[model samples]
Target chain A: MSIGKVGARKLMASFAIFLIATGFGMARYEIKDTPPNLSRFESTIASGGKTELSGIVVDEPDEREKNTRLIVETDNVKILVYAQHYPEFEYGDELSVSGKLKKPENFSGDFDWAGYLAKDDIYYEMLYPKINLVARGKGSWVKRQMFALKAKYLSALSKVIPEPYAAFMGGLTVGAKRAIGKNLLEDFRKTGIIHIVVLSGYNISLVADTVMRAVSFLPTVFATSLGVLGIILFAVMTGASATVVRASLMSLLVVLARTTGRVYEITWALFLTGFFMVLHNPKILRFDAGFQLSFLATFAIIFLAPRIEEKLHFIPKKFQFREIFSATLATQIFVLPLLLYKMGMFSVVSVPVNLLVLIFVPATMLFGFITGAVGMFSALLSVPLGWISFAFLRYELGVVETFAKLPFASFNVSNFPLWLTLAVYILYGFLIYKLNRRNTRKNQVA
Target chain B: MSQKRMAILLAGFIGGVLLRSFLNLGWAFAGFFVFYLSFR
Candidate 1:
């Protein structure tokens, strides 16, 4: 599709996402009824101490206001079992608890499971055991193994890099923690390079292509299948967080479209991904800021990047790196308003910071992966591997540190209304579309 | 460039600037607007 069309679509889709998200937020504010569902359950010796109940887990640790609670159904469900255990249970786990539910007490923070579960109009009841039983699904075993393997590789790769540089390398490779260190991240934030740190379509696709290339000896169909499986495994390993999942899905879709010799529609593909993810967990629409930001930023790239590229086509391809840089800058332009609307802070240095960091990011990731795999086979080689990896990361850190030190690297804007953010995006879309049209006609006349 | 394409381009430029102006992105939009018009 033409760049202008993509830009227009991006403008519309983001607007839609914003509206739906607002609707969910509004629902949370107004819906108030029923006392907290406090299920208390105890089993007779005949039934055994095990109890099973169904519940929804809204597992957002940060947004305590949106804590998860289960509505379980049971015939003799009046019993409330005090689930005396850590509240860090994964979201969406169904349980058959053989425990007792207790009355409401002076508990601080959000609703106690006993009370909250009861209020959900759930059919089952349980005040779970303090020494409780938790079983992650056997169905999730394959995904779990993939995540373990991916994380293992990431951690191993970090060992090869120097103290602080290892963290940044890990972030680039496997979307590992904020290990790139706070100060470096601050630099990236300032230069608008934070997207490089965040798992994005470029990172995922590069890795996917690398894996596919290695398996090229296999039949085309077989190799494609393996690549898709690898992508899925990588997504699972990355915690299948909304952003990671979305990027992985897009990468996989792009590959699938290309392999089948068909034109791909990135916007529709992205829209479908968002729709499916939200359908699976409607609460994510309200509760997950990462989910919103990931989709928005990516949508901007797919829609706006091309239009910007075409408008500036006067630049020679030999200097084509400028196109990549401009595309990055343009996406960030649309992304910043939404970022500021949600994050309350925008990094002024992020654009330059990202440009510098991205130049090294792909190379560093490749080296990190090779060293990680090598270490798995031979610890003896780890030192050299570690040395090489560290060298790449060291330079990366130096650049980040320098940019972060610049004045006005970060600033905050509070209470920017959603309407204003949306309007900015719409205008950006119109501008890109206009530029592309002009450029296309100029080329035609030439 | 055809007049139609240039018109679209100018429309986008003007619309973007007006919106940015309306929303108060500060002086950055002025330089951008001038640059865009000069290109046309």
Candidate 2:
């Protein structure tokens, strides 16, 4: 399974070619020119410090947060709408916000409307008047069916499980975090266990493994297919986001590689995943910071986490404390760079804070799932589950509050230059190469 | 390295850089670096 230098060289070339072709193809698409009487989406207008945009219902402003801008789309063109008196706008609602069209600052890029759709991957939708409420817009029926089935299954599971445990577990297992309170979310963030809240590949695998174990009595093919189908259903139920899709594809590729007894390269899997995503929507490559962050973080975890974990393996295997500490350190080392780049903060106490928070995350999520499931079945279950959910919520809140209140919990890294960050990344890469090579040699002899 | 794999990697790296430069998408360079380290 080791990739020698020769193999690496060949692979690198192929990847480069692929990237060039794709990049050229992406750049070839002509972006629509702005019309003379352009309007922006209402939400965009609300973000900016302006008023009188159509469909804007002004809300009370917080004095603390500043420099927020909004753009509103109306009448075939996008316009910059100020955030002075913005209204509450639900996602997917179409509004014809009329305003004076102006080119906004700080959004210069190949991707049209990159500034407006940084959080939302709706760059492509700018060409059209209405934003699709769902991803792909083709899987709505299947998604609905899966959702209904999930509700049914959760309702049934609630009969046997405790209250909030079910609710938390639902979130952990299925990626539905609606029931998770804001306080719990804050704790998970501080602890770096927020990935657990998001239904990543890890969660998908956990659910799939459980299903496969339950069906082990069946033949291997049937069991494997059942597990796959179950996961696909779960993915749909969780909205089948780009990250989830990438994870599912990677997991599926891994399984297929195993079944075929051929060692598939993970790097290829990553490239192919990105290639497919970009092929589906070229605009995704341009806009969508969440898509960018999700993939980048996963890349860091895959490529960098192992190098870190190997360095800390001197501690005895059976020593539970060492294992937890090493695991936390490894993941944090990789996550920190990307985290800072995205969030502009370097959490000084994130390591220890995450260690403490990790202890409760699994349990909290389990209880949450249980409670959420129970609530689906009856008021009988909801009553008890509500109390448990509340308890976990309270504990989670306390943890976040305490950690956040710490003297040096985190500090801003916004002032850091991009070159410095890239230099750090290069150094990190060299370190991993040296460390991994040494470990590989040791492993070969052992 | 096999010719095929080498070709793929080189193409991805060079092409990514050129595309990023041409399209004015500076982030493509970062993506190329990711490809280099990851696929390299």
Candidate 3:
């Protein structure tokens, strides 16, 4: 008997599932079997002596206020290097580094610093290495250009805006590598608005949305292509971190569906995007917290937001308040268990704090982007835009700091178990299933 | 296979990956095995 259309679709879906499962298994096996080629460096690390090694800086140096962190690659293994801010190094710098090599160790908290770095294939670390510049311009040219542009943009912002606000604007616009000070960063965490500063999917989606709207006057194909291009440029400009890549992939898929006139099935798109990402890099599946949070938050917004909106009839719908409230609540609820298990600090005031600050995020980002872009040409001309952005930044910082200072702002559940997190998600799945069934039955009766 | 069976199989595959990521290989293999037996 010949299989019908539906049967064929099901069969194809089953084949896809088989492929994904097999891919994951093979990836895990490969990671477990193959080891990093650190034969040359192992002796140097164990000797506990100052060793001189030469490597090209493979990635953008993470610049903070006092110091900078760089990933230097040599002998087919990556080493995380902590270097001084003076005589700064660029992304493609080739340097001779002399330092005592040490294995990355986990800090006091449950954070697995070693495993986190290992996910990126970084096994060794150098602290305050004496670096001698040997040469410049190594690694991918595109990445080098992106890093250069990002630095110039950040410098422009600093020229126009003041210290903390300028840094915050950089974080908002391009996921700036600079630190916003430990105390302010802690305030962001306590108030649960840290995602805004991290160049999250929300930021990428906002950019995508803006681009799509701006180019909507053009022909459909041209507009869609432009939107996709904008997404790619933004992803590249932000150093194309795993989170940015994932978000960009999702946005690209949406654009593709719209251009092809196919109904965008977001759930399938999300799953397929995640599957491909994991298939490419198995370590990230287990070790990348950014990947995990981005996936979960997107899933919650898609699946849980509407159900939450249904129950928020009492909340006014003005300014799309109800929609934002539900979406924020859905994401907060869905990510709560994971955050608690990983970070152990639950922001009791996260909902109110998020509600207060998130409304201004898009405007803040827009004004901040304008301020930086215009500042690049003329810092004098960018003053008005910088002022508007500074006002928004100041308000957001004030809200976070105020809430974080409250005695009951956040609670630390340092011992939150993995099992409990899993159980809570299972409960969430069950509730969603029940709600879907109820809605389907009501629709049938109607 | 029926649509219901197809959905279950897909869910099982996803669950296996989740287990592999969050727990360990043993749990993921066990999950895959259970789903494989059911599919067979």
Candidate 4:
């Protein structure tokens, strides 16, 4: 259904609010000062000289066989410090690193590595830093605890499952992709199922469902709230859930608007969400892809998923497969051009491979969670679940490998200009608006 | 869990993920909005 004319006034108000919020956020971002500590090192860092720097490990280390990459926030600057292999450091652990801090430079090819790092306000990097653990628990208390739980869960999962599979399960459940080798990782990207590795909603639901089930013995309200909290953490880990919360809340409002026959309320809600989010972090409106996508995808699901689902009515709605399929299709339709512009590779097999893998995602994730949770208590009790998870993992890998190996499975496109990407989206947004207006007219006729 | 609860939960989960995927798509479109406005 199109946007109801009755909500037109509210929509206008929301649009005005969004614009004001956006302007304010952009201004705030521009005027924002660099961290006090970082400002001290600005000249030293800019000189491109080798020097020692100390900072708190603001995030979990990306553990690769070659090196562990740590996002360290010094007094002021955020730097990517690479150490020799895993450095036995966790999040919130402060470290004194003796290494040359070099400014990020752009890659020779189409990829803008420097710009990417800059997106998160990181301008410097260190390779093979000499790291000394200065102190424990120097960052957020909540994040420290989350990382600890994550580490424990990961260790438990690894103990029960074998290598490669264990690493894959870690990626599937908690976005621990450092253990996943480059070749296999490429296979996942080629098959376009790499999203599963990240802490996407699917992964969250898997963990949340398990958490809910395990705590089912508890009071109903408590269990449900706990499950919701699990889902929220999934967003937080990605560093994009702040936007997700805004999107979710706004969409809920829009849904409410429809039910109450106050379509304007949805538009008003959208603007207000945008305004508030921009007010909180203006850079998100301009820089964060996750934030942008959350809004678009939410809109599509709210408007388009139902239409697509009806078209696919032949497919049994059993197990919610139809909904999954439709949702995937709808999101792809909206994101394909952008994905192409960013990833610079088009996987022709993305849809089918995603469908094949996504159906098994929840199952695989569920089994993986059960294995991890049960393993925490007893390896003997968790063995059966581990085996089941392994089975799902094997099947998923088979699908990904098979599709990735197909002749011309993906196209490596380069030099796709940003202007073109923008044009495509402008057209897309216009199309959505036109479609909404047309549907409004149709409803009026009927 | 009963079949009904199972179905509902699965649907909700899938729906959540779909919303996520769409947001990702919208993100891709941000470039368009900025450029379009500039040119216009």
lDDT of 3 by residue, A64-145 (tens): 7677999999977889999888898888899999988899999867788887888788989999989999999988888888
Candidate whose TM-score is highest = 3
The C-alpha stretches of model 2 lying farther than 4 A from their native spots are A1-113, A116-139, A147-194, A198-201, A258-268, A282-287, A311-324, A381-397, B1-7, B10-40
Clashes of 2: 72
Candidate ordering by lDDT (highest first):
3, 4, 1, 2
The segments of candidate 1 whose C-alpha lies over 4 angstroms from its true place after superposition are A1-139, A178-188, A283-286, A311-320, A433-446, B1-40
TM-score of every candidate's chain A: 0.68, 0.64, 0.92, 0.83
Best by lDDT: 3
The CAPRI classification for model 4 reads as incorrect
iRMS of candidate 4, Å: 13.6
Clashes of each: 54, 72, 0, 13
Which candidate achieves the best DockQ against the true structure?
Answer: 3
Candidate 3 CAPRI-style tier: acceptable
TM-score (all chains, Cα) for each model: 0.64, 0.64, 0.90, 0.77
Model 3 misplacement above 4 A: A1-29, B1-40
DockQ of each: 0.02, 0.19, 0.24, 0.03
